[model samples]
Target: MACGRFKELMMASLDGEISAEDRAQLESHLAECADCRRELDELSELSELVGEIELPRPSQEDMMKYWPSVYAKIERGAGWGLLVIGVVVWVAYGVFLFITDPTTGSMTKFLIALPVVGALMLLVSVIRERVNTSKTERYKEVER
Candidate 1:
């Protein structure tokens, strides 16, 4: 009954997915509503125009060259860089907080900080190595 529901039916009609009942309902609405009729016409024209468009498919060489160099390196570098920085800042802050807390014993703080610091250092080292490797391997393809 609502125009919005009728509009939905219009899309279904365009896609040839409307049932006979829905088609009759939509036609009844379209006959009485000038605005709905206009909208349906516009949607039909748009569908036709879009259907006529065809994008050329790139060759294998072009597809291979598209990524790995420009987008892949940039995306990986940025993501890794953010991860590293965030880990460092947050871990350092957590350590600083634990160290300064008066209620916690110095020994307890040391015990907790030791493993956290070790893990953080190992993580940062691995990430740095990975970033370096990625930089070097940017232009090369994986050998199968």
Candidate 2:
């Protein structure tokens, strides 16, 4: 077997999931292959260390402490998404104004307003949705 296949078999062997026949084959290979033996030992040591560590639950306060940063990051992403969409729309509008009515400066001004108004509307919607979601999550947390 290739080194990759052997390593997979070694992991299965350690997990006691490999059949007896496959276990025999892997053991025989491990005996001749120093690299496989080293990897198996490394895996065994890692499993031992993992087994020794304890997992502790976070307090409610600790969990809530992270909420602001998470919400801020989400809002920031939404803001950027809105910005990108608005810019694309603005560029398209500018192009339309240029091609369809280059002589009219008012058309350009109107085109500029389209993205600003649309972006403002989208920003409000995003903020509203975020507020609703945050409220629902807070309710669920309180219930728990």
lDDT agreement with native, every candidate: 0.90, 0.86
Worst 10 residues of 2 by lDDT: 135-144
Supply candidate 1's per-residue lDDT for 1: 42
Colliding residue pairs in candidate 2: none
Error of 2 at 106 (Å): 21
| Root-mean-square deviation of Cα positions for candidate 1 versus the true structure, in angstroms | 13.3
Strongest candidate by lDDT? 1
Q: Identify the runs in model 1 with alpha carbons over 4 angstroms from their true place.
A: 62-144
lDDT for predicted candidate 1 compared with the true structure: 0.90
Best by TM-score: 1
lDDT of 1 at 70: 85
Q: Residue pairs in steric clash, candidate 1?
A: none
